[model samples]
Target: MPHDVVIIGGGHNGLTAAAYLARAGLDVLLLERDDHLGGAAVSADAFEGVDARLSRYSYLVSLLPKRIIDDLGLDVRLVRRRYSSYTPDPVDPERGLLIDREAGAGPDSMGSLVAAFARVGAEGDADAWNDFYADTARLAETLFPTLTEPLPTRAEARALVGDDAVWASFIDEPLGRTIDARFTSDLVRGVVATDGLIGTFTDLDDPALDANRCFLYHVIGGGTGDWDVPIGGMGAVSGELTRAAREAGAELITGAEVLAVDPDGRVRYRLGEGEGEHEVTAGTLLSNVAPAVLDRLLAVGTADADARAASSAIAPRDQPPFSPDGPLDVPPVVRERLRQLAAPEGAQVKVNLLLTRLPRLRDASVAPEAAFAGTFHINELESQLSSAYATAARGGIPSPLPCEIYCHTLSDPSILSPELAASGAHTLTVFGLHVPHRLLERFSNDELRSQLQAAVLASLNSVLAEPIEQVIATDAAGRPCIETKTTLDLEEALRMPGGNIFHGPLSWPWAEDDASLASPAERWGVATRHPRILRCGSGAVRGGAVSGIGGHNAAMAVLEASVVA
Candidate 1:
């Protein structure tokens, strides 16, 4: 008998769907290609013999909803940092702008922030910053709640936003114009623009407004846009999801590589090495893989079906009954739709480093603890960011490469062993922007990794009192505890096409005005052309970052369809 639901790819999102569907009384089966769960969200010891469990790929948390945590009873703690962010002045290494999270809106509450902005020659930007974020906070409060629910129509979402000015600034026009109009300081503008550029390759002024979409996801997390540090790292988040899935009776199979998927809810896979192919059928199938990956699976399934049809060896009894309501074969329209999606190209360089101690900053006004506790921006002035993007688009690595660094241990030291913690060792995660995946074709992975690593350190050293290389901790094997993953590296390891973190370009959380929301899947924004198959990953609407909105919505869609049936 077919299971009620089958989930492909046991990432956090897949686990989320399994847990919810199983708890709702549906028989759920989840398959993962890797030996372990938590794709890109897992914590591991990147440094050989180091007693550190670094959140290897994706680090900080912001987008996950509390509803998911409470519903699943997940034992997770998200710690907000004291400092929101610190960006050193690109021209003056000794000065920086630091935004304190604890700073309120009252008089004298803005004193320290005002001075910091003044120090960076952004005297009036402190108020601008506050005004800008206040708008985002309102937007977050309005739209964040709609994420786990059905896809609201564009008109509905716009009306819910309520403020005409906020909608016009964020949703109607390019984000660049707003940034330019709101803040005068290039440094301040760049700090604001970073949100739009994170993991997204696009011009801020581009009419496509991809940057606007990226910016929306960034500031709307948790309704406050505070990116908190997860206690025990990202592994704890996935670990809790895994536990919930298992406790809810979701049968999870690791080391199961899915070879093909039929739209009629048939999945063929090989389990581990030396294993024969196994086939399973489900009433509903949820895809946690990238859309491109799903298309490949469908193509493979179609080819396999054709070869079987031409053969006389297979008996009719061996075949699963094809649903008359579903397509008899993988439709050409489905392939064309997937092809039309923007070719995902991740334009960031991720570097994980273990430091013996936090490096001192050139800006003496701010303490090292405060500077590194939150996001530390380097050479990311608005002018510099645009220049870098222009250079990168022309197929050359940007000089004075713009990057951001943050210390996980500063907020939560649980990731390190007690001895390392006592010895003042910390973990620094560096995310370098504007280094697109296409660069891999020009240089080998090793060559690019080396070049990028050097460029990253140089960028960091530019604003440091001392070189960061000196503070890099050594592992047991006498190797530096610095590891880097390029977009190409991410694609090879995580099966993300072009190593795009959002799986592909992110979509608006709501449905378009002309969209057909007739089906439960379409209403939830998880629909593909196939009725039984739905996206439950980053490719789904309101999907991106570490948020399980995709998984949550997909499960809700299935249950809704069941109710209708």
Candidate 2:
């Protein structure tokens, strides 16, 4: 029942792999345990029967390679670029959000962006972002040749990366420290600093914060920060890949779980309902699941490579999606100022209040765009946030963590159906941080509503002075399951080796290194000994963002395996 290639997990990236392989004329089959595919990128009932985005996890598509879009003819319905940013009070008049509503920064405008960076963090963050982009992007842009080039021997890669020492130094330094020494403004710092810690455990205050800066270099800004969802949701990316894979001639199986991947590359799965076992042997196998998942699968084959990665981070039970990451808590009321602060991601779970109308933040002081664009919200200051983080780290809800309220409807009007818009309603993405999943974990699904509602209402009243209890429709709810989960918050969640964003922590040095441990060609995972069979994500390469470079380069290695053979 098998052919060219079989893909595990129907996550967008996995689908992307299937698409490319199938398009290349390889028979492909993708398997997902869920009846509905699209993994984390999905939407469900907001609460009762209303539809809302389940962006509880993995929300933006900032780095999906464009070649995939063009090559596969993706039916992507982009929500369009409507720039919106939050600023301290007294900045904009309409909605307390600064938006380039008119796309105001024309080329000649030299638009106040760099200067604004200076405003946010003195002269450093502005200059840093500028310089960071210029140098890294240059390398990133030109990487296709080598990354996709046939696999070179370990010796070959070393010669290439070994030439760059200064870049190497940049990699050696702790990411957080790099940012601290460079930026003066907390705004700019938070903006750039958040990247380092975004998807991993590198805390902002972790003086060893350079990891964030290293990660900042990895923000493959979707060729300019346009990471977005297609008309449907992130599902579009997976949809297109699935379609392409089928067209290229791959059979995809959903609701089928493969129990093992042997050292010889045999895939074993449940054949039918109440069925025993079915085995499909393929030329090679790939895993998109966490390394821990792979380890157990490959354990059947006793593959050392699989064993190493799995033991490193994935095997542990109880891994949360957002680990070390919890709901954010801060209160402007605490300090009466705009400062960077986050208390806890657990203990005080954040409840998003999707609205039917544009929130009237028109205080004649704040920017209107901030009211509805990209993870928008209301909040408190730094001290409150810090206090919230500390308190939550100890497992207790702060009576009044600040608030984050966002109306996504105004930014992407299409999120609502004709019926919803006609009713003066829009999509809202509210995030509550520092929420302890255990609090809700203890309650029955039915009884949890009041408890969750009361907690948010109390926090909002104390910190935001807004009545959220009335704003949230009791019937509508997004992914309640994902809402209460955090991958790093608890001790048992799957931990990527070293708590790094990539399968493991990656930095410029790794990227700039050659295929060999010694020189240029040796950088990356190019060393001949570095089996392409076990490559990580595309962004796994030293470059940035979650680009498929690692996969691309690894694919080339697989292709090279053919050539070398």
Give the best candidate by lDDT.
1
Give the alpha carbon lDDT tens digit for every residue of 104-133 in model 2.
356732345544433433444455655654
User: What would the per-residue lDDT of candidate 1 be over residues 128-151, giving only the tens digit for each residue?
Assistant: 888988999999999999998999
What TM-score quantifies how close candidate 2 is to the native fold? 0.69
Q: Which ten residues in a row have the lowest lDDT in candidate 1?
A: 316-325
Worst 10 residues of 2 by lDDT: 336-345
Off by over 4 Å in 1: 105-107, 312-342
Candidate 1, clashing residue pairs? none
Q: Highest TM-score: give the candidate number.
A: 1
lDDT of each: 0.90, 0.47
